[model samples]
Target: MRTLFFRSASPSPSNSPSRSTIPTSSPRHSFSDSLMEENIEMAQTLITKWDNSDVSSYTKLTSLFHDDRREAKEYLKCVRDLQSAMHHFVNSQDSSAEKLIISQNLMQSAMKRLEKEFYQILSENRENLDSETVSSRSSESRASTRSSVSDLESESEDELMVLDADQVSSIPMADLKSIADCMISAGYGKECVKIYKIIRKSIVDEGLYHLGVEKMSLSQVQKMDWNVLETKIKNWVNAVKVAVKTIFYGERLLCDHVFSSSDSIRESCFSEISKEAATTLFGFPELVAKCKKSPEKMFRTLDLYQAVADLWPEIESIFSFESTFAVRSLGVNSLIKLGEAVRGMLEDFESAIQKDQSKTPVPAGGIHPLTRYVMNYITFLTDYTEILADIFADYPLTLQTPLPEAYFGCYDVDESPISVRIAWLVLVLLCKLDGKAELYKDVALSYLFLANNLQYVVAKVRDSNLKYLLGDYWVGKHESKVQQYAGNYERMGWSKVYASLPENPTAEISSDQAKAYFKQFNAAFEEAYKKQSSWVVTDPKLRDELKVLVAKKVVPAYREFYEKHRVGLRRECGVDSLVRYAPENLNNYLSDLLYGASGGGSVSSSFSTTSSSHSRGR
Candidate 1:
């Protein structure tokens, strides 16, 4: 209060940038030297402390430079100078004292700062300094660039023009030979690709071959010398490209320890290289048109194939998702051609084998040589069984055919071995017979293999029926047998097995266990029956065959049930009792009498005559 002087305290910072005339925009480097120097000093101190295992007193001591910009800048300048000196000390030839004085941490700090500045500059100026921007700058700059480029281009054209007949033919060949030697020596695949491109371009656009033919007789060369040479050169270039691309692409850098460094470097190279190659080779407007119009014709050219063949490894390596798909479409066409060739060769071989077989007789030993050969062939065929089964699993809906036709398709004895044919027929009967034929019958072939004995055949048939029935296929023809099996199954106390099936036949079944098997078999039959041409007539001839089986199974069973329980069943299921009972007792009693009296369930009721009539008679 002596002078009544006071200093106003600074307000606390708010969210918004405060307005001031203090040039708070910052000197940019007001804190720069201090910030960098302090950061590096702190980092170095921490690193030294870490290296020394001094963890007790490592709290940041960076506050001194934070508040005083002037002092901070001065300190930072000194630190930066120290950092630069350390870098120079490490890099310089004078080793003993400088090496001892400069630490790895100080060198690292300098590198970090240098790298940060470089990246910042690059990021900020990338678009401004790019090729397109540089090309379109001020008219003076553009004109100067154009003048320089034009002059170089003209010089190149003049050089091209000066090439005589001998020179044109000899130059490229000589250059290729030298490059090939260099490539073989250095194993520089990228350089090889570049050389090939130059050669190809010379042959195509520069009329190198026309010059080559100047001294030769016109008749010795093709009418269009440049075009023919271009085609050949293109093929060669493509082959090299493919090889290089495969080397770069197919081998994963991380996985292949031998090629890790090279692969990593090549991957970076390929990213930029492949984009240029794709645009040049396939994405060019003319090439795109060709692809769209007739891809097979365009890609199938020998030149293209040659190019691809040479660089298959590189092509494989560089192939991305979109690229692979495009390439494979081309490959598929090639495979089709190859397949046709292979098919022809196979037919010839098969013919020869058949002729040889016809000439030879069966051996007299315990095993015929032909029999062994046939067994081998059978085994070979069996190998495909797994493949076919896999196909069926993957594409169950593919099995669309009538049951009989499907049976024929399965057995196909005319084209298969007797054993295989027999096996197939068993499968067909097991899968499709509908269980209509009586046990131990002629059509059922109940005596064949494991198909004998009513109990055995019925069990086998029961197993088959259960599999298909739950698939939502009716198995209507085998319904009675299924019912019979159900009765037997219940009597045997197979509650779990019975429960595995739909509890009510009329009700829908839902079981995860049966889903896959059910889906396949049902799909097969549905596809078969849904065909319009299956029966070939309004009244199919097989109708009677099916009905006969049904009648044999149903009629006798119905007759026996009626004969044994007619009186009792009539009494229980009489129309008056059915109507009198209405919805409750009627359905229950009628079902019991109808199915239970037939012995699907236990029945306690028996016929009873009136007691009044007996008393009257006595």
Candidate 2:
């Protein structure tokens, strides 16, 4: 007797094995038994061949069933022949329980063999497809190498080849998707997670490529035009957008097919991609610093901040948790950097002013130029403070609470609250103004300059919205300071004038002695009046206080002198020359003298000058 075996219907010459020959007629039991044994053995042999074969070859063989008509017909013929052989044995009179069991085992073995072969074909195709992709990429890389050879003639060929190989080995999206599909179809869904890792790595690489950090050093970036840097940053952000979209699409596909129940896996994959995107986006601050060579160019901070702020909505949509966290982190960091930069700028400006202070003298008639510049800078900071407050409005309470302490590095002494750090900066500037005022040669003039500037500062604070930052109490304190300066001016300015007065007279004096005393007093009063008459007092209340202070000091002393010396002074000079000024006239002169000619006011009528003429004999 001979044995029969099954074979693939459309076998390829390279992959298909030679079929065994069927047996001729023999004794009934032996033929049936031998046939059944051959069938079972044939099924096992086919299964073993499939298990041992490479997937590429198996896939090629399996593909023939769909592509080649003859192969499909041959495959169906093999199945039909096996079934017919089994039926033939079962129908026979000699078909006993033992024979039936052998037949049943043969059919089960054949089904198992077919199932195993089917999956093997899919696996083999996946590997072959990946291999082909790699080969094509290698060819492209080689072509690139050849193109670059002339330019890179001095470079090592081995180095160039290594670089090209690395570039080619990076998996493309299309190839990744194909492998993932094969894995999913073969019920090896967990294997598709590898595709997400590849995608996330590619996205990160893409982000770095767009960032171009190695292409330009920070110094080089600093020298770049702001517009050029802005364009580069916009391009980087656009590239990030593309990377985000690509990752989203890839993850969506993977999650739909492979990671449906593996949410942790999905989250892990997206988290990595989100971090890469954030890293790329956050690099913008370095670029902003580079573009901003000075804090005077603080608009760069604003522009960079605005650029990132605009993208936050999109980032949130794409990477909910990861991107929200990144944006908030960037915001906090940007706020800190902005504060430091602004602080540094103000400090530098202060130092520059201080350095120039001794070298530059104050003008005779106006505010110092540095004073004007610093005041203008204060105005800018006033607006900038509002911007900062608005920016951190949504920030954590801890960040918002100690913002001034962090920026100004000052404890909240009750006199200078932390919330009033801007006000403190202004106060510091005013102190600088005070230092400039001390450079004047004249003591009274120094007080006058201080009075002008201090009053200006007080008026600005009280009149403008800056009062809110500096506070009502700060303004009041400065206003009182201005009054103190005015009072100092009065005391210093009139000391010489008061010193010329005669001491209190205990006895009558000669006409000539009285003549000398009245003459010296008149001369000193006239000179003091001439010198101080042109000085300015800007604030009305300060002007009135100064006039009253001088009057109280001068009027009573002059009144006593006139009463004591009038009898002899009239005998020495004629009655008209007895007193150059009456007590009332001196009081009126004191009021009118120090205020500029423009300052107009009325003196009290109650104080009278006692004018005496020489009688025939007293």
Candidate 3:
């Protein structure tokens, strides 16, 4: 039988078959037992040879038992061989120098026999496991056998090292180095490593090897070839880089996939993936660069920004709050500023030019606020150069200045008085406060001054508008009706003044000044409203138009107050703060102020000559 032949060919032949040898008898489960017996016997022979420092023989014996077996025969063979080798070394006195040389020659003969058996088994195993489906399993089994051979070689190598250390401890450095180089070139890495380590330890113990290793390890030129070391380092970096990139892109794709799935399931999947990202890849610079490079594309592709908004807060607490916030907050701010500025400019220009009144006009870009935010985010990096440089090392190109994009698009606004005034305010703010110039105090002062001037302009306009509405009642109006009312109260006795008015004086006050000023303003408005009926009704169409205008104005008062509060309300009373106080009254005031003129006065024809002067005043 073929099995019997393989068993006979193996060293330390057993009364059975090898695993790779085909059985000539009827196939039966007992065949596995035969293979196991043969493998175990071969393992013992290989171990004996390995312990005796017969490396060539050890390698030969290892080849025999290295094949896949359903019964784990090959694995058992390897294990048994290691055990036998360990036992042989522990029991043998052949290690003594007087007996070592003679026994070593005998050990080599036994190893040569074992090597012949191993090669027969390995070659047969390789031939048998040559199927594609079995390739991986076959390769693994081969690797295990190779590793066992390596182990045997290591044992022989250790014996040599023990012999060398005893004999060459007093040898010159040059001889020791030559031995190292010889081992390295011979592909005896284990032997080389063991010997090198011992040599290093002995030299260090006596302090002789320091300069040599230093010259090798620390020398700038790396006297020995280091391409292997360099290749290994580069390969490691590339592998990690590839893994990181894959995860980043994969995470976004998964988020997108989950988003399109059922909402609850998607949310759960997204949350899990996001948490994983935080743990695994957050702060990886390469990923950050990729995301930043195509921020709009990145976000739009998977709505990653929105997903981050939903998930990052929870993740950030465990990761790094400041880092996450610094990136996202600046992004959000840039977007908000860009959107507001562009929208304000376009709308203001459109209104000024009556472009919206035309049949067709260009539409403003409808990119999401966050897209624009990303577009403008680089500025923040440049503006906070030191802080950013500490994190990123260099400023990104997107963040640089000089407005790479132009603002050449046309806008049509009539440049009316209101338009001119608003444009001036915007220009002032831009010139003063917008950018993060280091001149903080100067910028603050400039902003304060602009705010003060704006407040003054609004106040003068309001006063003039009120004067026109109050007619003769305000002809000699020296103070606010509230101040005037306070004076009247002082002139009268407190009790009399209190008695003359309603007990509670239920009057709405502006938020700017609570109860006292409100009562006075209420009284003034009531008086003006009562006198308003007497104004000429010449503009009947204007009255109807005013009715619609008044409604529209009051409806937006709530929104205006909200916006003003968000912006930080100015102290002076103007439409900005007025809406917060007596919204209805302010609405009425605006109506009467725009449409109702006190019957006491009208613009003379000469008023027309000064229209340009009023325009210049704006």
Candidate 4:
């Protein structure tokens, strides 16, 4: 019934007052008739003016009347007075009822006109707000122009100030906050997010936000003032925090209601919300890249990430009402990405250092910087590994299906467990070190470099927490490699001594022949021994092993030949006899051949013999 009454109250042109309905004649020219005529004329005029006016002018006129309640009341009173006059005139005995009805129609038309004007003013106000909102969004400003009609009236002066300050493009924080709060209250959280993105872009465009320093060279970053850089980062972070907080406020209401009774539906809602939140907080990778560009920044960022990770569980607990899987996974993915990035940087650093080291001469008995750097980095990995495990503690550990081929040609799918990837990375560094060792011109030096570095690596691994990750088999394999390097060094140095010994000496071989062969052996041994003994074999155990290796090769062979030839050999030159030295003397010399001798010395220290023919006479 109420709906029908409102529908009937709306006036069409036919139902409205017309001049034809007014009487051609009246009984008296009374005051009521004159007053009614004047009120109707005023109402019609106002309606005509309102119809001719545009939305902006109408809005302004409406504001004026609305602000002054007494004036609005006076307009309403005139319409009522006309209605009362028409009713009294109709009841008079001589009055024309048609004239009274026309006056009543005029009063109704005026009331409808007022209602139409008020409705139009509201429509125009809404349209203007929409236009300004669209314009603000396009300009990428956090300052929104949309407001309630009351807010519009109150903030009009401030709006003028904003327009005057537009030339400066500095939006007041209060204004931004007001706009953001309005958006959040109206459930237009996405618009609130747009405000944040616009502000962020503005900051970036103004060169206030630093991103992706990884592309810059280390020298460039190093040249920057530390204090200035620190301030810049602090400002950037604070701005991000503020923007993120705004977005959070906008999302809080929606997030609270996202839960569903069905598990799958709830999960889907959670996924979407998380995706939105992640999009809002999407600058982590760039921040990580900036840290990667410098070691100091990298460590600092790592510490920051660790702090965040540590705080994550508490954050998750607080937001447990909302599904946290997506957010938790995001943090996990970030840590993994950072871990991989740090690994990559270390690999690159290792390669570069090795290349530099290879181009320089090996320092005598000193550890290479590359070695120290690698070991220290490995220690860092141990800590990082723990952090990763902690962050991913609830994560599924089911192994991913192995690819048909290994990822890098070095890592076998079956052997490459995720926990052991760091170990594999260390193995790669060691392999590179070995390749660098081969760059030495002297074969002995190459072997020595390998032995020293490999031994150091094995020792450090044995002593550090890396042992658990690499395992006993890995340790054993490297230890064997160290032994092999020592053996090779000894073989290459003693091959000349071995070559000097005749492969076969006949039973009838003459003393002169033996003398020539022995002379060759003495010269070869002296040359090799003198050169090699001064060479470094710093490890006591390796040095002793190498000495024993030389003795085993030279002493037995020389002793077998001397014992076989001694019966028929004539002692022509006593001290320089063909079979000059006893087996014990040869053994002693060979013991000190590589690492024990001070420098080049006599070829026969214990080989003196008398030049008497006593053996033949006897």
Candidate 5:
């Protein structure tokens, strides 16, 4: 550049106008014409020299940028010079047609070098240019790009670029930005963008692959064993989070910054790189949703639902561009399909509870298997409350009839649509349990079964997330029902024992009547204790409460009967045989009643009650 300008400025004897010929124009105009002629005639020295040599050797392509950043700056300058030459060839009248051809050729060579450099930088520094780091550090402008993971050795390589491969960073972000801007402004933006899309897209797809997200057809997912499918669902739950949080996020940051000169290019490149991977990533849950609906698959569906629902904001933000709308649509579509599957599963689950035809009553009047299964299932549903609340808002409960008025009573299902839906499911389970209680032969044992199952339901609601959704009103009401069931059990089971006593303990009867009454009491006590010894209460608190209740009713009445009549009877002969049970003996028998002895359906004589009929549950 200096040689061309200086030579044109120096005196040229032939062009000095010979001092004889009059000048046709001003001295300033004459000088400008001479300068333009010289530039047009000599040809650009820079583009010709690079065109004639091996660009890789002279530039040491990778090393030049990484080791000597000054060479990188010089390279951008050469791009600018070529652009200037092309602008002149297009606009200047005096420019030779051959110079325009040379500039075009030189521009292509420069663009090729930039493309290769861009690829190498992205490839070699994949980890360094990771999404987490890129998104976090990308907020800095070109002035501060050197301070990021790919820090610059020198900031002097123009505003957008300076490169060095060293400790923490491979090459500063500025280097890529500079190359992109140079090529874009030089009428080669399309080529730069194409190279960016290819390389960055591979990184995105590979990230998804490593994260275990795959594009699976419906048949492919359906053929998988449930255990295998569940594992994949869990992996996808983790993968979708990473893809949105860091992978797509970083790619978007890089794309926007590099191609910041053109909004259309940035949008188009990001969509091409990320949309497919993201669509596949999100489309997975919808596939899982299409699998055979079962009670077991409900939790998996909820997990998928939750994962997508959780990352939806980021998904929307990253895929907001019109070109990437399919990704957004797929994400939202997955959520919709997942919600539908869950609701369908809910209906099926309730029907299964209703149709349970198992005639075999739980032994010892313990908790029913259906009771545990339904409560456990609904309890898990509570963990998904916020999501389910939204889901149920759109699809309200669709039972043939509204919930029974007395079912929830004062509790308002309308407070939250999901709340009512869950409450309805639980009520359906309770109704099924009521029908199952009829299978028990003894009315007393049936009442005990209801008490045991209801106690379990109350505790489950009290202890878990159900307490919040169902509220204290529901729990308090159900708890009272449990107390009523236990009372009915006590009354029905012990009525005969109470009837054996006299209406008044102090009313004096004859000697023979007293002896007859004492014998009647002894036989009744033994028979009732033996019959009830196998009955069970699964909740410890409820079991203890029932014991205290029955004790209050039975012990006092019998104790008064014993004290009054036994004194007179003991005076006669054979008193020990007549009075078979003391008040202390009654207490021992009551302790042994619910805890079925090791021997099934049999009462141990010692009545220590060392074994339990049912395991205690919350």
Candidate 6:
């Protein structure tokens, strides 16, 4: 019963049964047969001195183990010797049961000292043994594992370097490893593993806290306002990358290194240390996904989903044990929830475009408010094409009853499904704007509104990431529609102006008929010019192009009519009274139109009375 309290004094008594850990022998001889009896005497010195209450020897023994690292190795060697002594005693033909009990008691004393050393090493070297340094110095045999973890880290290398900058490798990995081997071999693995789990788990938990991760419940996230919640999501994006690439990654390396001699000890220890923290880190995204479903929220949500997927390989490799399976499941479930959230928001956005109720038309057939909102919204969505590709694969926009080929164009929708969906979103906005155009009372103004809005949408696509997804072909096709809308506007708005001029201005005609022709031209020109002067073209390139086209259509023809009739129209009446405009005047008037400014003094308002009299005379 000497030294009986050694086992009871341990923080957690070992329930693991004692196992013989002596090395295997050559086929020719038993290895334990050759070990010296003197090897057992070395450990007995400290065990007997302590148990016998030899105060001076006890103080010296404690000093040798704690203050001298050189002596620490010598202590580990004594444990190994004690282990061999016990085996030899059990297998010997002439062994005393009393001697075997004394050897066993000495072995327990050595294990108690070694267990204290193990806990001391872990507690004192938190920074020196941090995951960053540990993962970098991981054993060569785990090169494949380290390589895979490095791949996850490459996803966000600059987010937070995680103490690698001023790292000092002060934790002697070899010393911890040597002590672990001695204690675990002598059936004290439970005590060694318990100390490891407690200290390292705190490091893992605290690491997450420094990285800005917290244990968020579904209710807390659900009640968070999006503005506040979105800030949290951005922080989680950086936090998760650091947690996986540094925190869990370093721990996996350190645990596998220290307990490399026992696969089960290393696996179980790492599982307990990292599982809960990892689960909470990964579960944040899923909770965020559960909270909201809005188009405005989709981009930040995709960022969360991407963080999980990018680290999934590392998560799988680090937590590969059956004991840590819940960590891997947490990561995958996050991906699934974030994906579901993205799809829901996309549908919500599509529905919002179709259900718009802004009934009032934009002033002067300019860009509608909905066009600006939807185009800006959809343009930004194109930034997440790759993640959206995975999401949209399952929730395809079903074109059950397709619009006419003219509305969208003949481009193939199958080349990329993502492109098709974005194209469809733009089409829905165009359709919504088409409904808005109808609110304008003037048919010409309706075409002008469509032209102005379509030009805005095309310009948005060409300038942003949307250009890559929608392609130059899509851009070209819509650009032509913008021209087509402008053409329709010009044809309807100026048909009366074209009608007032003679088909053949140089053909000989009576002075009275020529006077009437000049009279009719001024009235048609003034009214159309006055009305169209208030319309707008929002895009600069389109605006300049429309001004040029109207000049080409009107300028030369009006110039020809004036040159042919000058003498006859002056003889018919005062020429200035009938010809209110020259060829130069026509160009000037067209320039002043379509800028959203109301009527300036008309160049030809004097001709309106003559035009009214002519209307009655006709």
lDDT of 1 at 241: 46
Deviating ranges (above 4 Å) for candidate 4 = 1-289, 295-301, 315-344, 350-357, 361-369, 388-420, 504-508, 562-571, 574-618
Per-residue lDDT tens digits for candidate 3, residues 481-528, read 323322322232122222323333333324544323334434544543
Candidate 5 per-residue lDDT, tens place, 473-558, comes to 88888888888999999999988888778878668898888888777777777788888887777677788888889888788888
lDDT of 3: 0.31
Clashes of 1: 16
On residues 501-579, what C-alpha lDDT tens digit does candidate 6 reach at each position? 8998778888778778888889988899889888887777777788788778777777888888877667544777878
For candidate 6, the C-alpha RMSD (Å) to the true structure equals 12.8
Off by more than 4 A, model 2:
1-286, 292-295, 298-336, 359-366, 386-420, 423-427, 430-434, 503-510, 555-618
Which structure is stronger by TM-score: 3 or 5? 5
User: How much lDDT does each candidate structure score?
Assistant: 0.31, 0.52, 0.31, 0.49, 0.74, 0.74
Off by over 4 Å in 5: 1-62, 98-102, 138-143, 146-171, 398-405, 410-414, 597-618
Write down the RMSD of all candidates, one decimal each: 31.5, 20.4, 27.1, 19.8, 6.7, 12.8
Q: How do the residues 1-618 of candidate 1 rate in per-residue lDDT, one tens digit apiece?
A: 322223222443652256575432321222333333344456465334323224323223222212232332343344345555445544545333633344444534333332232223223433332222322234454335323423333344346556443333222223233323333233343444443333233322222222221222223323434335344435444433432333223222211211233544334333433333343343211221222111112222333333343454444444543524454344434433432332233233233333332222111101122222322322332333432232223222212543443223332222223222323333333432223222323221211111111223333323442222122222232344434533432233222222322323233333332342234323432332242112111112222333243334333433333233333334443423322222232223222211111111111111011112212222
Higher-TM-score candidate of 2 and 6: 6
Best by TM-score: 5
lDDT of 4 by residue, 152-268 (tens): 334444463454332212222222333333333323334334334333333322322233211334355446664455444444345434323333322332222222223443344
Q: Would you list the clashing residue pairs of candidate 4?
A: none
Which runs of model 6 end up more than 4 angstroms from their true locations? 1-34, 45-69, 136-171, 402-414, 570-574, 597-618
What is candidate 4's local distance difference test score?
0.49
Scored by Cα lDDT, where does model 5 land?
Answer: 0.74
- Candidate 4 lDDT for residue 154: 48
What is candidate 2's lDDT per residue for 49-139, written digit by digit as tens? 4342335455445542223424323433344445555676677765556645754554454343334433333344333223233334443
TM-score result, candidate 4: 0.42
